[model samples]
Target: MRDVAQPAVAAPAYVVGSGRNATLSPGEIGSFLKFDPDGSGGLKPRVDVPTAQAVVDKDLSSTEAEPKDATFSFAGDAATVVPAVTGRTIDYQKTFAGLLDALGKQGDPTPPTTFTPPPVPPGGTRADPPPATGRAVNAVYTTTPPKVTTEALQAIGPATVIGEFQTTGFAADSGQNIKRVADQVNGATVKPGDTFSLNDFTGPREAAQGYVEAGIIEDGVPDRGVGGGISQFSTTLYNATYFAGLDEVEHKEHSYYISRYPAGREATVFDGVIDLKFRNDGTTPILIRTLWTPSSIKVQILGQKRYDVTSQTGNRTNPVPAGVKSLAGNPKCKPSKGVDGFTITDTRVLKDVKTGQTTSEPRTVRYNPEPQITC
Candidate 1:
């Protein structure tokens, strides 16, 4: 026995690298060996089949796993991307084959062995790391990003109707004014946290502004004014924006109730003296759309949906009861329509379905019955 030489033995296991050098223990690697298709090891003096496979599997799993992808979220005014994670897993059969090759070549002083790492999966985007200040950022992975993104919003494409109102009764000249005013308000864009004004956008109503003489309600009587019929446009816009959950900066009800309007929710604009104003107290921008037919005027608002608004109108009170009066002999005198006088209030409630939040706004209007008169 003095001259006999002992056979060489392979190392029990090998170390593998992962994200930031995370190590897999031999015990964990040992569990995966039975799944190897090829018998563990071929040489009698080398590491066993299970041990060799365990080493390979652990290394492959560590370096080849794929990461989870990122996603977007909107909370109030801030747009954010939730961060993603990285994952890895190796090619089982090939890596295991490499391990078999290493086991066959093992010797008394077994040196560490390595196989070429598997190719990385295509570079996928995960949410970027939180900013140094730990604030969320709006970053995305694809060319077609989320619709609510700032870049996507910058172009502001055709809007989706969020709220709308329409009326089908109009006189020709009044209809012209309605069309002209609606044209002025159409395509108007309101930035986040900004205010929109009917008078400002429509400019002064004069002959030069294309305003024609139309019948308008003035001091409880129907009078002719250059921008007379524009009140219908104002009323339409008021209801649209009102339902869209905007804040009314200034609005006034008509002195006399017009049967066509939605009770107390209407507004009247008289160039500089009276104007319809509302604030876009929202996290995103909004668009105004106006449409006018031969006998109809419609107004609509467009923006990202946030709040759900519903309106309720109280029953009419103080009905003067009479309905129209006829007056003669005064050609220049304005006519009065004797509709019943009444008082009513409208309540608009806004509910934030996402956050379970709510707010309410109310408006009360009193209309004096304008005795119908003939010129």
Candidate 2:
């Protein structure tokens, strides 16, 4: 038989030598001169020496994938791959901690995807989470310089004109309203030496202003009046002042016994008519605070007291016996008519704040019930 012919399998080899077709060893990367774009293996001196060296060095370095210095080195046992990637020395502890924490959450539940249609609707529906249910901290801050809100008044009010409070009552306005305007006025400050007006703290009460006319029993019949039932206001104030042991400079008794006010010690008031007044009776500015409860109105006269007192008020109705002849400033008094009346007496337990001394005393005031005639 003739000699069997062997087919050749061509595996490329690199040559490193002075020849234009120099084949290189494993240490050498490519042909010495230049890459032939035409696939011919012959070297062409097209590139300059500098550019040729750069390309040659890049290939040479790339071929040695593992650095010779890294072989068999245990000195940097704790170092990481790409240690200088962050442009700073690695905090190995923190880096591992973060990595471990991430791995720990590998099984953590993903936040459920919500199909919110563009802008989400308010108020949680069945599909939504329960309106961010949690024990959240609530904080109140003034949004616009503590503005007076109609919503606040609307939400808190349309108050029952208790026989003890008026439009100037704290219930009718916000604390900011009272405190802000009071700060603007001068002689309005009620120091130990000065007397204060309720009107002073609340600014002015006027007809063409914010106040609405209310019906009040004037003389005997219910008449439309401004600041009517303000005497009830006076009563609340008196109760506070009396309790605080402040000396009252000027005050009055109502024309009739008002069930809500402190008895005899209370002062009555009517617009352009009767007025009730009091003093600070302390060394500091006395701020008046008022609060209304379900059954009663509360007034707080806050100040460093000259004395302390247990001021108590009780009501006693002295009904005009079917017919009491009226003579005090009323010509329209019905003498021969079925009528009723009452009286309220206020008692105070006085105590000296400076000395811490205490005592009980009675404040005398008289409210003449107007005769309601059912003739």
Q: State how far residue 340 of model 2 sits from its true place (Å).
A: 4.0
Measured over all alpha carbons after superposition, the RMSD of each candidate to the real structure, in angstroms, is: 22.4, 30.0
lDDT per model vs. reference: 0.61, 0.39
Off by over 4 Å in 2: 1-189, 199-204, 292-297, 312-339, 342-345, 359-361
**Shift of residue 303 alpha carbon in model 1, Å:** 1.0
Distance (Å) between predicted and true CA of 339, model 2?
6.0
Q: Write the per-residue lDDT of candidate 1 for residues 216-254, one digit (tens) a residue.
A: 655444577787787888888898998888888998888
Q: Model 2 over residues 77-158: C-alpha lDDT tens digits?
A: 1211111110112122221222212221212132222223233232111121122111110111111211222222222122
lDDT of 2 at 67: 15
Q: Distance (Å) between predicted and true CA of 136, model 1?
A: 56
